[model samples]
Target: MSDLRDAALVSKAWPFEEARRVLKRYQKQPPEKGYVLFQTGYGPSGLPHIGTFGEVARTTMVRRAFELMSDIPTKLICFSDDMDGFRKVPTNVPMQEELAQDLNLPLTKVRDPFGTHAGFAQHNNARLCEFLDSFGFEYEFASSTEYYTSGKFDEMLLKACWEYQKIMDIMLPTLGAERRATYSPFLPISPKTGHVLQVPMLEVNAANGTVVYQEPDGEKVEIPVTGGNVKMQWKPDWAMRWAALDVDYEMSGKDLIDSVTQGGKICRALGKRPPESLTYELFNDELGQKISKSKGNGLSMEEWLTYAAPESLQYFMYLKPKTAKRLYFDVIPKAVDEYHQQLRAYPGQDLKAKLNNPVYHLHGSDMPASDMVVPFSMLLNLASASSAEAKETMWGFINKYAPDATPESHPNLDAAAGFAVRYFNDFVKPNKVFRAPTDQEHAALADLALALSSEEAALAAIAKKNAAMGNEDDLPVADFADDDFLQSVVFAIGKNHGFEPLRDWFKAIYEVLLGASQGPRFGGFIALYGVKETVALIQAGLNNELTK
Candidate 1:
């Protein structure tokens, strides 16, 4: 193994470790190709979802890690299996009845239901490209229809024809008795109807590179496998792709673990070694059901990007990919907040720590030097509570809290504020319920409001005291701005009024102010919302004057 690969194995970073494992396997017996190749596959059955983005993004991250660890050149192929037959109409697409008419036909041959592209596959493929391009992903896209029809897969198709019997033996044992009795690795496209035929093969002529199958109309026909006459069944196709492209690494959802195993066997049977594979856990919905594009059961990429930055989604995928996580709209705020926190810490980190940071990897070599001026969660709150329509309105509040900041200087904050406004209008505003505070909670908030109203006076006094002590430049703003100070102040008031353990007091404050049990740090919230406005908000909550 190279020094870089060795170092990667010990780094303990998951992406690096994954790359190290793949490289180690290659080192044991190198590939036919000189450089590494990473592949991520998409079935153009529906629009790209969060899972699609996750697969491509995670694969890209692994590819990046491999590039960093070794001098070997690398390529990532975003392959679309557009040649696959349309088994059923997608629920999310239009003209479902029209799409159903083309059942069992290659997706690329089906009419574009949305009227936006040449075919069904083309429409989805175009969408996938647009989505990936928006995030500036670097990859080469290959369409299976083009590959097969243009003779790029001729040699592999002929080889599969020659090894048909052997491939059948390898696959049949894994199938049910009925399937085992009739299964063929190749499915011929009927010359008459243009539908892919799944009929039983009568004979295979290895030398002629053809298979004879009885069509639905009861006619036995022989067809070449080489000239897009036939397509490999998915398992065999996956194996053939691995061998044909000499894929070094690839990943799939955990549901494909069995297929990966079967593909490995089929590849070895074809005199080619299977690629190194990782089966990551699939994303689940809030109900704990596995998220599926076909089922339309989880959050969409559009929904995520609509509310948060692309980097936030990338960072969410970067973390613990091997474990299943809920991909829902509710998770967006935390992901956005986490991205900001990482960006903030990135500059202070050492080289090793920087490399380990998710933000550093998300940006590749062009890591940003600073964090956003305000947390996205806070921005969402500010935008929703104030009904801010434009970035200027949010910026007005932000500037009031952090006078040193500017929209031009903090472009990320500006952009985030804009997204938060749109997101709040669409998702948060209609759903939010502002509850009136309890009498005890109301009393507590009233006291906190009184304290906030006096904050300016306290700050002025501190400044005067500092000036007298010959430390005019070192105002005690940090002391007051700290969460500890806010916690201490809330705790002291709550303790005097018989509310125990400061946490309940803080939770009550959050519930009254933000309509949640938790929120952005109170000190930061107060600063961003403006001390006077926060005091008034608290006073409104106490008086039960806020709207529910």
Candidate 2:
């Protein structure tokens, strides 16, 4: 374990360094239990979203890192705050009318408007389990309602009741003047209406562990804090949960930094220390605003998996956990490409380097030994350029490139090809509007077509020229070697025609041929799609047939 710590201290990976810090903290003040606990929270007021997945995935990664570095047993708890009241109905949910009527009631008490579960909270919790199960996350799910009703949290609730004044002292300073006078650490369940009441506590009897509060109908009622008669406010509840579960680590979004700070204070008041906490920046939508479930502005978990692999989404979460990232459709292809690149490079790296790789962490002990047949971005380009609508059409070209490749042997590539077809249709096809080439651009395209028609001759001509210039070794070893042959052929044609700003030449080729301003490398596309088909496509663009 000391060797593990020493090795982790020198590693460049953030997860390793984070694990080192956590282990050190525990050493200083050890947890009450033998095993280390990692917790992630989800509020069951709404359906599971992408942010929910991000938190669990990241926490699991850190937990895995800690498991590798120490002999300590580790447990991950996916805690659901299902006992919370439904302040308002989310726009994305069904049965808005019924939900609106249940405001101020605990989510577990509200009816399952979807008619799929026992209650609203149960529905969301089940959905969350379904979502996490899709990714095969190993976690223990704990419901706040069950914890409260089963008396698992009775000791913490009683402690909060006995120390109510101290908890109030810790929380009041952080609230506004108007809320300070009315605030209470315990919110009692209304016996009349079955809703969680936030009204002021009229009286407190710490000796009896009971508090009296007024309901909406002006009825004063007394209730015990134990046996699920009351629940603490958010900050105090967060602190109590940490102390009750002996949580070693937990993480939340940056917006909750103040809450964490306040909760730490409350934890101290309750005679317990708060858990180690991390604050990660929130995800932003394409519009540069925070992703809101009510607004429905960002990609959902199902939407992302619809167009990309699950590993790609996990990889996205694995990168820069503390940095804010855009979770939109446009970021999907790049994430897929990066995942593929890392997987391809994983087998060649040393042990430490391999462990540091995102794919290695994302896949854990089940990391694949081989790379995908091709890059996902290239597959997208191939699908778009070839006008293919089915995975079979794309697989034809992939099989041509690697004859031995089969779906059974290369599942990632097979999955990527299917996703590429879907992605091209949803995101790429509608935006494709080819432009007619000008006369000068047409001449450039003609030269490019001629070069493609006799690629071997073109490469030989460049090799002869290079050999004459005392740079014989500079000749390309293969047609696609470093794209040397393609670059030489294109540059020779451009220099002969005196074309200005060679970028416009490539732009013309892209816009006319692919109906986009940018795309995969032209040389690779030609090599993969074949010279004859590319020549014909370029000729169609030159003749103004592409715009049709």
Candidate 3:
């Protein structure tokens, strides 16, 4: 354990690096709050998406890293800013006209369009918690409405009131003259209309913890900043929450860089330092447009999960977070395969290497073994060639390659088989384009098919000879089972038929036989799908049977 901790101190993984930065904060002494506090804020104005989950997932990764390197205990809080006003109705939900009527109301007060929960924010908050819990994250859920109305934030709310001018001085310079004249850090909730108003504050009485503003009817009213009567603007609210909660570490999207800077200044004005933060680049759609929840331009968490396991999504999140990447359906298969690839490499890695591995951060010391003996890409190809409708169909092929494995023993592989079938049908099958082989390629494929047939015949003759010698079950099939051996045979055939550089031969095999521009190693695919079956597939391609 001590050696692992020593390795963690110098580990180059991003999580450990971020954790070290946080660890520096308490080098002189322990925090006055007794434990480090990690927080992730959410806006429940729209449905929680993959980007929202990434914030909490990445924060947890750093929190896990910090736990590994220090004796200090830590706590994570998933804070939902459900108190923000519902500025516009979402186009995706039902009862849009109803939601439009409730504009300018706090999300917690707006009626749920789905008619399922207490309010719009509550429904979305439930979804946010469901996905977080589904991932088994360790954290406490905090609601902005609950904190304000329950007096948990009263102290900071009062502090903001007293430091109102200071907060204004920090925020005013960032705004134009029109918005600057009316902007107050505090937004008062109107009593009569039940709307959160953005009107100019007529007065701020720090002594009484109240702000005076004229109602829409022109009546002068004094509202207490505490007790949910007023909510701070997002920027000030961000700072006030940090001071109130004593957050040690938090992370936000790249778009929030300026907001983070302003919030840090506001926190300094309120006599507290801001939390250590990482600004991660936002995800983009396939076309490179920034993914927007309202615009519905990218894959959702649910959609990603439908075709791959949740860990793959986390694996995607765990990559170079500072580098922006496209988040779309096409990225799923690669993420799934690479996640298992990392899992396979974890056990053999030395301590320092393990410390740098993602699975170590993702699963910690309780990492599971990678049961995906068949790579996801290979499974997709097998499903494509077989036109598999059920996982059981893929299992027939998987069992031929790994005779001892089963759904119970290799659950990951079992689940991936299911995912591969769905992925092939939904994404691959529709786009598949098989072209007829050219003359040279056709002759090469025929010779390759004949060669595979001879290999099969030789294997059968060897099995018969072994059976006559009372060694049928123990026959030396390893040589024939070897992917490289079969690959070499195919390479020899391709080279004999004038396939210079070899990659063109493989590319032709993929485009002509598999209807894909690229595919898994033909040797591995043949080993999994059986030598005779691949010969039949090749013959079908040559005769134009597949394209027909």
lDDT of each: 0.81, 0.82, 0.91
Task: Give the best candidate by TM-score.
Answer: 3
Q: Please list the residue runs of candidate 3 whose C-alpha ends up more than 4 Å from where it truly belongs after superposition.
A: 456-478
Tens digit of per-residue lDDT, candidate 1, span 223-291: 998878889999999999887887889899988998999899888878887888888998999899988
Q: What lDDT score is found at residue 206 in candidate 3?
A: 96
lDDT of candidate 3 over 1-548, digit per residue (tens): 99889999999999999999999999999999899999999998888888989999999999999999999999999999999999988777888888899999999999998889999999999999999999999999999999999999999999998999999999999999999988989999999988889988899999999999988899999999999999999999999999999999999999999999999999999999899999999999999999876666788999999999999999999999999999999999999999999999999989988888888879999999999999999999999999999999999999989999999999999999999999999999999999999999999898878767776643544454455447646434435577876776676567667777889999999999999999999889999999889999999999999898
Query: Candidate 1 — which residues are off by over 4 angstroms?
Result: 1-9, 28-31, 455-487
Write down the TM-score for model 3. 0.95
User: Model 3 misses residue 505 by how many Å?
Assistant: 1.5
Question: What TM-score quantifies how close candidate 1 is to the native fold?
Answer: 0.92
The CA lDDT at 313 in model 1 is 95
Question: What are the C-alpha RMSDs, in order, of all predicted structures?
Answer: 4.5, 2.5, 5.1
lDDT tens digits, residues 1-548, model 2? Answer: 56545555566787776677678766765556878999999988877789989999988888888887777888999999988877888888888897899998898988998998889999989988998998999899999989988899898888887888888888899899999978987878777887887878888887888888887777778888887778778888889998788788898999999989988888887788677777899999998899875566788999999998898999999999888898899899999888888987888887777777898778865777554767788888899888999999998888766778989889888988999999999999999979998888888778777776675766665665565557756555446423445667766555445566877777777788888898776766666666677789888988888798
TM-score of each: 0.92, 0.94, 0.95
